[model samples]
Target: MSSETRNTANAPRPTASEPAPGSRPTATRRQVLAGSGAAAAIAFTGAFSELFAGTAAARGHGGYGPLVPDPDGLLDLPKGFRYRVLSREGDPLRSGEGEVPSNHDGMAAFAGRHGRVHLVRNHENRVTAKIGVPTVEGLTYDPAAKGGCTSLELDGRNKVLGERVAIAGTAVNCAGGPTPWRTWLTCEETEDRAGTNGYAKDHGFVFEVDGADPRRTGAVPLTAMGRFQHEAVAVDPGSGIVYETEDAFDRPFGLFYRFLPARPLGGTGSLRAGGALEAMRVPDLPDLSSVQETGARFDRVEWVPVPDPLAAGTPIRLQDFGPKGITHAQKLEGCYWGGSSVYFVSSFARSDEGSAADHYGQVWRYEPQKRRLTLVVIFGPDTDIQLPGESPDNICLAADGGLMVCEDGGGAQHVLGVTRRGEVYAMARGRQNIGTPEEPEWGEFAGVTFSPDGSTMYVNCYTPGTTFAVTGPWC
Candidate 1:
């Protein structure tokens, strides 16, 4: 499923690859896409493409400088930056149920009681995995399943207080979104049903995890979110609408979905109340990867009702959607809400795999008010997997109003930062050799998120399953 090995031998580097960091400063969260500031407006709009195209040899963004080698052979960061390993796979948890699960994927940090922070982390494990989430009785939805989420309690100084299984018995908990009502929505990235792979229940569904209180979290699935290969999700604060991404690569590809909850923002278990699920249809466009031009704008967008969200019969994407078929994209990975637009990522596309076109990656911004979706960032094909902008996944709005993107492209893994001026820079690197030292294999970084105050960053290494809290000087 990793795009690192894709054939990009003759592909051109993306226009936005490298740019010098200058006098421009980071924009605030509200200014990111509001078009209220010059830097914010130009950063994502078509102006960015023009700026990159005009510069022939520009390479630098005011990122913390080059990453210094880590003495521990794990993570590398800028000179002044420091990181602490909060949890690792096989480490004993405080709950005494089992060790920390493997394959850490998507995560979120929330404000906990008494000056503490709670991180709800996801373990992308399946039934065959050696280390799965601890199957706690009441918290376990299916003992046959091995993927779920765990909550780590940390003090103000980023010290781990306790770690417990928040939810278990799910499968492939890849990514989910933090709600406006102060909870984490953990999503299952599989469509396996009961009896399939020995699962006691359906696998592909969303579950709510209580960040403030792990004991209150349960393994109840939000069935209406549409059962599919879910990757990540983002919630609109104003509308309380949950926008989800499907990371499916089947014949029909994946569709972008929006769930209109019946009881929006009604605290913890509200999503279980169920809602209407619909897929986005861009009028004439059936496949989004065909859009090669940066800043391609879709003025009018329509939402098609998903007839069978539960997928008890046929999968949602295979269902009929009238003469005007629904729009689909390849490798839809991450979703995050910024300003008024909900941004999502298409990790990459391959023409040979039934895609209409191919590209390194694309980031899209969808505004509900305008009912429009715009291509904000596009990465042209490149031969180098080390490039910071390839196969971006699990993105987050940086505390400085920029974007923090996790690289899933093979080779050496990295956490990349994109400035408001469309400049890309390396923020961190995974130096741990998962394979033999003679033949190193770096794991991808996922769940890049900032604390409520934006002082620390929490990320996970997909292999070895290590969680890190990084602190550094910010702009």
Candidate 2:
């Protein structure tokens, strides 16, 4: 069961509950945000202008350390780290499973037998697959919905053992969260309703998939979690609450929400049973501009009950909470459950995206314990979106308590790292071009995550999709 020799016609598929080293660890919301981690989050420069001393459009040099360009030009990693292309957009499978799907977006790593791991990978496909992971009968909801997830096993050396479709026939499976109960929550990055986008049913929703499920359970949409252009989710183990991020790029902006499950701590399949979806509202913050000032801190924030969880026509942002001050972000994308808080990335606020106020990017830390959300690591206009380490998207916590952020902004994409000391570094930079002279590969990196034991890191190249696994003597 090796990556290179995976062309066997009848290779045994790896089980989701396949035993491994140890289950991934979890920390309480308070412990994650209490001391040093909280201080480090605040100092990351969410005060856009003050941190960089200017704007992203005008800024100079930034990045934790120097990126030694890879000789192959596919990725520029720091000195000690190295990466391997685990799966390509169109590689044929070894077990006759199917070709690796394109549009790789969100992903999670679950333990496998003998120190191995299972990566539940998502594809952000909007239309029917011209060419991608096909619809599996038992796993598909709508044949026309070309988006879904694929599960693959990785062994000790970080090589693919086998690949198979986990969930099938959904739409725009963007980014999702890894549940404490050992499952992946796949999110849809679309608001295109059923009849409008040629979809048989409403599109925006979240589906859960267990990597160890020896069988596919089909598409299970957790409607109670709300319906909109969902980007990602971060779970709070202590309280069965699921924090969700919306990727609405409109001027009105996207809302940060949390779903309170009706069935407390019901684990993976809990949301579908029912829950109360609520949007975040800060006391004094009305517009998105209030946080654009950099180093802006909003304490004592509360959740506003969403008027309509299923935002069919008028999204939750425009519903009742709009006037009540539901704080909005330019484009909320990737979010991770940081030990004591939830760390989320707000992809640059640009006027082009209908935003009056624009920024390179901003990272925020939401401390549920204190009812506070702090603005951290803000890039001004001077910051270079083209250079690397700007406009961050999908994020994951490192074993060392640092943050791994996928650069989704512009120029050459990179996997950026943020230390507890509030320092930002280029962990890995994309090199290979997926497009031709007319459209050379300029894809942003997504699905940044680490293996359970923290020996390896996995990330995705969004366009002409591809996934890479990097191993190194992590700092």
Residue 410 error, candidate 2, Å: 2.1
lDDT of 2 at 404: 72
Off by over 4 Å in 1: 1-61
How close to the true structure is residue 201 of candidate 1, measured as C-alpha lDDT?
80
lDDT of 2 by residue, 1-475 (tens): 1133211001121122222222121211111111111112112343322222111121122333456767756666665667777887777755476777789999999997788899999998878554556777688877778889998888888777888888877888999998887889999888877776678888788988987672534577888898899999998877878899998867588889988887647555566678788888766565554455443556557677898888866877788765556778778887876556777778778776677667767777777766656665665343344555457788777655566778776566777665554455567778778667776667888898889987888888887677888777664
State every prediction's TM-score relative to the real structure: 0.87, 0.83
Model 1 error, position 361 (Å)? 0.5
Q: Compute the lDDT of residue 475 as modeled in candidate 2.
A: 43
Question: Candidate 1: minimum summed lDDT over ten consecutive residues — where?
Answer: 1-10
Candidate 1 structure quality by residue, lDDT tens digits, 1-475: 1101111001121121122221121222121122111111112222232222212222335466767778767788877888888888998987788898999999999997898999999999988787999898788989998998988898988888888999988999999989987789898888898999988787789888896665675778788888999989898877678999998857789999999888776677668888889999887789999876665677677788899999989888899999989999999999987766788899989999989998878888786776767776776445455445468788887776666889898677888776656666678889888888777788899999999888999999988898998887765
Cα RMSD for candidates in order: 10.2, 10.6
Error of 2 at 69 (Å): 3.6
Instruction: Give the TM-score (vs. native) of candidate 1.
Output: 0.87
